[model samples]
Target: MTLWNRLLLGLILLSSCWLGLAVTPSPVATKPNVIIIMADDLDSRQLSCYGGKNLKTTHIDALANEGLKFNHIYASEAMCVPTRASLFTGLYPVRHGSFQNHKPVYDTLKSVGHYLADLGYRVGLTGKDHSTKPKTVFPFEIVTGFEPNCVAPTDDYQLNDVRKFITRTNQPYCLFVMSINPHTPWTVGDTTEFDADKLILPANWIDTPVTRRQFVKYLAEVRRLDEQVGEITRLLKETGQDKNTIVVFLGEQGAQFPGAKWNLWDVGQKSSMVVKWPGTVKARTETDALVQYEDITPTLVDIAGGKPIAGLDGKSFLPVLLGKSSTARPYAYGIHNNIPEGNPYPIRSIRDTRYKLILNLTPDEEYYNRFMMNAKQKDRNSVWFSWIDQAPNDPNAKRITDRVVKRPAIEFYDTQKDPWELTNLATDPTHQNRIRQYRQKLETWMKQQGDAGAALDIVYAKKKE
Candidate 1:
């Protein structure tokens, strides 16, 4: 223990301490840029990335190749406002109480964007924010994330504006890019300079002359949307942020067709979901695991290491994204409540991997005939509405519309056999056992989630008085 020996030992201790400090992971390493590109009323079967033949989505296809694509992703509610609200709040439409299109989403609940903003991330939204009620008066500085230099109603140019925002932002950011291109008013020609003839019709859709013409217009809009996606991806690559940012592309709901958006069928609830997280998620992977729009908020929060609020219906699938084996929720719940000028007061559904059970709260006649007049009125302004109405004029339309509108009180479908869900097997004795099991499960879930519908009888009684 001489003076020289003591000095050497002290130096060794100091070096060890310094090495430990140098190797510690920084907070920045845990944070990643999050960008969600949400499409309005998009169907999974309509994208090239999802085996859609009618449309060419090169950019989105590239994203799917580079990341994981979900085969069975759904919106909590099959409508714009409610689905968006569920995505933001991680709650069901009944819980959030923003069940209708024009209904406002309350700001008191925490949103993924708000959480990121609180955690020192620059948050912005572009295109469409269909949250009926956005909590913050001025939640985002850049509305639709479009730059001042960009022209309006042009998908390509608007996406360029999004890229500009990403470059201009000084901090880590969460950008919600909402697209309205594939929505309604299917453009016949180049409303925004994209090819229309290259578009193909969906295999399931009828190939009649009228159907073909209608589908061509719809395909043109889908192409426009794909172009916008391409531009956004190009922007990310140009900025050198493609590898660092986690890009998620999803549809708010299904295609805006008859018995689609407002119904509880696969065509209404199922949507396209693609996620690209470089270095973490494996490329060219596809997952058939069931995921809901409500799960998006929790997953984002988990990735960002932000605090999750209590009573959220969604469970985060970060492990699934990171190429790890994990257990997701066993089932997803769906509600088809109010649609403008359309109704069947309240309908609830439960979908597992194989089967879907729908409970019609209103009788068939009351739900169909009562709403026919209102639907006809809505057709006055909406091309989709007008087209759907023309179904009665054509025998085929009559058949399709009849199956859609004359839904039974309780309907069951084997999702594996019937992805479009054109058939109802509720009355089939062979499937009676499966139907009962799902019905009971739905009731139990409703009770567990404190669903207002579970107490609908009481609520209606009080309302009558």
Candidate 2:
């Protein structure tokens, strides 16, 4: 062969080798690791990252600074069992049918953990597992990827279980860390020490002497919860999985206080949501887009490059997190129900960016008075109760208490003007047109979703007097 032909042949071979290297798939990025950290009965207002001042949550704040923070996030329901069930199934409480805290509904639907395991990703749940009955078969029968380790209803053993799993796992995995901290019974000393005086009361809540005192205790509990979160994040870093894993931190429901946990108010359904996806999400980008707890499953599925289950009530926010602008949810729905011996059947609400409308199906005075009555029994000495009990004698207290207790069948609040929802505009003639519009929207949604409330006789028999 000629020298020129030999040189041409050598150059062509080199070019072919470079093209092959460029076209190869780069290992597919290994199905990113996922970690969901859930706090029980935590309020968004209690987190420093969410404009809270009572406790310092430096670790969570750091995570928020590194990723996306959702301002208008909501829970599926204002109660534990239902909210967690919705998170797993990407459905509503009525559809999943886990109506109360003691009722476990994992058997009725597939869990996100199980789906991930089926797709070859290791999955495990540590800490509180409130989905299944104490001895009922969990959705994931064999722990296909990682062993199941959960905290006892009254014990803190799950923390160690989570640490062990992270340390031992050798494959890409998903870990659901459910913390029992910050739930009711307000005890101190489990995780961190905090002073009561540091707590800040919400503007809507009465700033009476009693309310201030209760806030102190509540603030301490929030700080302790923050420490637990810090410990978990530190473990991720220690295991060297912090950068590769996407961490989602949020609350299961609102605080377990009056008009908070078992009510449809913002305090009951609003949650603190922070997502940290090291390379994907932007640093400290905050969006007020409405997001529901059910959206969590779909979001994770998108991140894993897996197809979402059909008939899901959630939409993925993957585009928004990837720095895409002009992404937003139209509206968010919330439900409140099934407190032990609590009066009234149930309530539902829908909120857009500017306004919130609530429908009280069983709007009886007796039912609305149940929470106030319970407060008197649980904490007679509590400043909150003392102020309410003395309302008749104190004109100022009466003015505040009466307005909340005598709320109407339909309630409306211009969220932009009254974010705290202390004032009700349901009866005001000025908001009549707005009320009709929202009521129609709520009705259309209820009918389309086939809400059990529509077929109460078949789904939920009326109670005897």
Candidate 3:
């Protein structure tokens, strides 16, 4: 057939397939590629598109401009292993048996790798294999490009393997391009670009020289993460998979700052997810529909023409992605077990769109994280000591330090008015009713997940090989 005649016939066939007249299973057309780029220890609120006053994340903002930005996505457990374990398995931390940092998911559990691969997709992960355990459970084609170590001093990476993986024509791909930027030792990106004195600090942080220096490093990595986003999306476009791929950018928990990583504060549990599904998800839009890391795998499964895996803690939020629903869940839950990272302090939280309730399972004990609060470390920037040093004169610094160590039996905050959750309204008589309801809901969820709360923290958890 002539070239023009063949092109016309191809267009007619595609039109008939869309109209359900002739539904032939075209592997690439039926199953869109899924590329997920996750940032390590990311404080997503620092991104300009997320109301950040820091440097404009031009690359990530471009994705938000071309796709949908999620406002209420959370990490559930706030720790690296627990959060990622929950994400890969679609189960809460306790249920998956990775309730503590560095802990492994249950051996018998199934991960997104198994689920997506079972559905005929080439599932793979490139970096940060914290959740890729028990190879029998997670059989991802190990791609190489990004650095996998979170605390590596240098984050030099090449995209040769990444380009090859996305360009393959045999099957649709679900690639997790996890970036270990902005993690501890924050030495990956360009700190020269940020003026430490002029940057906007978090509402709850104290302005200290050490803190500012470290923040410049952290924000630089955030910029690096955005650059990686730009590179990956550009690869997709060059390979002609941009229109047939769903690009998801995840700010994996929060940064490794004292009050952010191992705690239950909003800064710790809050995460970000931006989805770009060309011709499917609406562009230049935002959603307040609650979602968590646990919901990610289920949504990917749904998108790959598979049903929601029953018995999973997360449900598919594809409806929210497609703008078919305004809400996904009534509440987003958070869990924190501070054993491996700190003293035995367990926290459970539940938040709706407006209010957040926190239950400290061991309130009498002071909370402590050795790495974040260390005062004796000389080689690296121990910013926590500077906060303590300034606390004597600066009341805000004192409040911030005290806020990290001290605790209460119950803490509640109106997240709508106080996004940082600075004030504890648990004692307010007017909010008592709402607090009680959230408490009941949180307790029920804990029970459902078989979470022992403070008791689980007493055990010393170790990483699995």
Question: If scored against the real structure, what TM-score would every candidate get?
Answer: 0.82, 0.84, 0.93
Model 2 root-mean-square deviation? 6.1
Q: Clash pairs of candidate 3?
A: none
Q: Which digits, one per residue and each the tens of the lDDT, describe model 2 over residues 181-259?
A: 6665555533235444444676656556666655665556666667767887887888788889899888778775656
**Residue 337 in model 1: shift from native, Å?**
1.4
Per-residue lDDT over 242-286 for candidate 1, one digit per residue giving the tens place of the 0 to 100 score: 888999999668776556676677888889889999899999999
| Candidate 3, poorest ten consecutive residues by summed lDDT | 372-381
Question: Model 2's lDDT to the true fold?
Answer: 0.71
Candidate 1 regions exceeding 4 Å error are: 1-30, 144-161, 188-208, 366-397, 454-465
Which numbered prediction scores highest in lDDT against the true structure? Answer: 3
Comparison by lDDT, 2 against 3, better one? 3
Residues 279-304, candidate 3: write the lDDT tens digits.
Answer: 99999999999998889889989998
Error of 1 at 13 (Å): 18
Indicate whether candidate 2 or candidate 3 has the larger TM-score: 3
| Model 1, global lDDT | 0.71
- When 1 and 3 are scored with lDDT, the better candidate is 3
